[model samples]
Target: MSVTSSDPRIAGARAAPKRGIRFSWSDPLFRAIIWQIVIVGIVVGIGWYLVHNTMQNLAARRIATGFDFLDRVAGIPIGESMIAYDSSVHTYGRALVIGVLNTLQVSVVGIILATIIGTLVGIGRLSSNWLLARLTAFYVEVIRDIPLLLQLLFWYTMLQGLPPPRQAWSIGDTAFLSNRGIKLPLLEWQTAYGFALLGLAAGIAATIWWSRRASRVQEQTGVRPSVWPVAIGGMVVLPLAIWALFGAPLVLDIPALRGFNFQGGGTISPEFSALLIGLVTYTAGFIAEIVRSGIQAVPNGQWEAARALGLRHGVILRQIILPQALRVIIPPMTSQYLNLTKNSSLAVAIGFQDIVSIANTTLNQTGQAIEVIAIIMAVYLTISLSISLFMNWYNARIALVER
Candidate 1:
């Protein structure tokens, strides 16, 4: 039989596809439009309710919300600010800056020290020797189980109960330990100190160059390069050279017995000492676990292959294991860094005068809780974003390209 347009099937197929749109839930675009409309409605409704509630609550509480309080003199005294912070001369904005600096000071130093300790402990936990592995595990478990605030209190109490400065314990006549915290010799700075600082910067740049060169050489030749000499020369020799060139602008500000208290040297307050020690110890325990897991993630086949290539244990770890492990370690490490930075807020408990502490004081003095809390949140958000950006960039650099 021949087909014709007048036939039912033929006519249905040729009828311009019915000239009608059928709505179906299975259509992804339809579902997406529905979702968007629902989400926008919910969000807008919630926002409106919140704003209405906030206005009513503020009126009931007789609370005014604005940023004008930042200009008012923060009459609160910040003990242990980096700069002179009397209740006399600074605005709340200036005091907030000082607090931010203090937070950074503790967090930066704590991160560096924690990384060093954590890496060593992590490596020890992975040791072939039974004794080292057990010891490291014990340390990690013990420190991890305790709350950091409690640890800070313990360290503070212990340090604060030490003998007075007059009878301070001395280590080789260079450092003093007492209830006043550790007193160490500081270099009295002169104009020439700037050159020494430049030298230190140059040394750091040289070290980075050397490390990159060494890594490239190892990758190409399968030969490990010595790092100790370069480390010593850059860290020790270069700084010394710069100091000498600048006629050594450092005068030892030795702590001398003066009447009843020690004089002339830099002192660390008990609050600072306790906070740093606590943060370092607590953060390091978690970092140790991250490092251990990262190291363990490298396949056994990798170790065997490297061994078959006649690589020593150290070479295998450095060239084959650590590079791979770092990729695993870095993402979790970003979280730990962010945690440590935010934990610096706990410094308020000990009167360490970090950003949170100053903000709290400013709030109390100015009755601007909303503004102060907002500022604290903004500062922390900025810090977290910065750290995230840097770590992500570095992580991308080290990440392996997958085919």
Candidate 2:
């Protein structure tokens, strides 16, 4: 070292270590804080300007601003309501509640039906049967290509074009289909129905616990328990037994043609029927694609390994492939669900009184445009957030963890 040549490395080695720059603007932590402060300031400034402008406009027009308008009587009649609602007696707030329930009813039912249809189609597209696969592929292509609104309108028109009530199509007098709508026998609920529902809830909880236990058993003994039988017994047999013990508290209200319309049973309005059909069919197409991609993403080696272990096709799919494919399928599946929910707002176009429809009517009648819009936004935001949280939890539960 004392006899070092004119080499930069040797000279540097001989020299004392240099200190790093301190308190520089390039420091990550300092830069982050500065950027954050700037963003906050910009956001606050924008929000204040908007609020001030809104206030000035409201004051100029002498328009009263508050939620007190919610208590005013809603003179408009809702076509379909889950709860008892009268135009003369109910407030706008109550109307909005009815609308919310209607939206939930459609969204929940649509989700369940879409999932079933989509899964079947997804599996069909991968089937060994040529005809089935082609048909599935055709279905996905046709549905995914068409506009949802047009499909909804078409369905509504078809429903309305059916024969009138007097000449309606009947299924053994148990159900009736006509321009009026589809009328089916209704289940009349009694006080014991509450207990039966609780029993069903308990049964579902038991099924979940049993499934976890069965998984552990399979891991230890390399033998899987017959879970389906146990699950069915818990969910179906136990619930029925509980219902029977409670004197089977259900009454069937059958529909009968009376005068101009079918009377005395549950009825599905054409608007609701159309909206449900469109949402399910449209959303199912996207879900099918998601599922197909997920299945294809699983390595061929995994399938080969399962086959080598003498596993049956069903077992291979259920025990191995599905578990892996779900890790891929769930995230996109969640987005489809959210899309279906938000698309339910399209019910407004056809006079199916969803939250948006009701809110619009409220805004027009009360001239509370700002409040109505705010309420609608809040409702949708809440629903979307709730769904996102649930999906995230489920995704985490199924996600792969490397050790």
Candidate 3:
């Protein structure tokens, strides 16, 4: 006998492995994979068929489909745009670019304002003062109940009802509010401003680096270095120094009445004003609820434990509560962000001329409805995916790790 092994596992392990597909319904993993592949194939096939059929019908009807329309001159009159755009000079592409910028301009600012307002309202909802809590609750209820479209219309009408430029409400003679919209002093921009901005950006980057280093040092030494000094120097002092170095240009272009309207200054159009006010007010209501719920979702024990540590109320809330609460808050917050961006499309109703408004104009003028629709879908999908990815990454980063 040559050390005969009776164990089935050892014998099987020593045996040559079987090769080739074993088509058995009892093999769960294999069957599941096979079914998934089959389903995916069917979906792909159906999609291809639909696309092919659509193309055939379009061609038969002589409906041209391509992005070539983007090259055509866009004679569409845009009231306001971020970039240099003229109906007589620019192509459809440039007009669309302007629309995108306008949309981003509204969306980015709306998101920031909404987040700040919502967070405050959410905290206020749990305030010790009965009046503050009740007031915040009232705000959330009333704002959420009313339709956003109606709000937009109300704001637009209100702005339009303002007095003419000649008799406009003056803010210390530096700004004016009129039916033409709010006119403010425009910065006479210079190279020095750009250098100051660059210094600010660099400062921010340096602050971040120093913060990370401090965090690592704290982990190793159990003594946390304060990051505020660096933050202030980087964010404030550095920019001021750069600006002073470049002669500290602080020129302004004050608006003056020109015939029927104000000129020579920055103007916030009524359309944009209405849209931003509507979006921020409407979205902040929902976001407030999300924030409130997320905060409440934390166990009472967490609060008690934080208090036991003798940490200040602000520090405990910021360092202990929020980190845990974010897990609940972020997923819903991402949805609200997407909603705000998509809702910006409603700007068309108020003549804000966001991306959707521009694309609609493009389709009507070019007779390339398909292309324009595709562009719209692609833009929204890209933005939504980007928000989702960032939120998901952040959520995973702050997630509690198991030992």
Please, what is the TM-score per model? 0.82, 0.84, 0.85
Lowest-lDDT window of 10 residues in candidate 2? Answer: 13-22
What's the lDDT for residue 334 in model 2?
91
In candidate 3, where is summed lDDT lowest over 10 consecutive residues? 12-21
Write model 2 residue lDDT over 172-242, tens digit each, in one string. Answer: 99899998889999988787777777878888898898889999999999998878987888788887888
For model 1, state the Cα shift of residue 328 in Å.
1.5
Encode model 1's per-residue lDDT on 1-403: one tens digit a residue: 4446478865554553355433666644456568999999999999999889987988799998788877777777776777777777788988999999999999899999999899889989999999999999999999999988889888888888999988889998878998877889998777676776677788788888888999999999998688778878877788788778777665888988788777888888889989999999999999999999999998989999999999999999988898899999999999999999998888888779999998888888778776788899999999999999999998998984510
Q: What's the candidate order when arranged by decreasing lDDT?
A: 2, 3, 1
Clashing pairs in 3: none
Q: Report lDDT (CA) for all predictions.
A: 0.86, 0.90, 0.89
Superposed Cα deviation of residue 149, candidate 1 (Å):
1.9
lDDT of 3 by residue, 378-397 (tens): 88898779878988887777
Q: Candidate 2: give the clashing pairs.
A: none
Q: lDDT of model 3 at residue 391?
A: 85
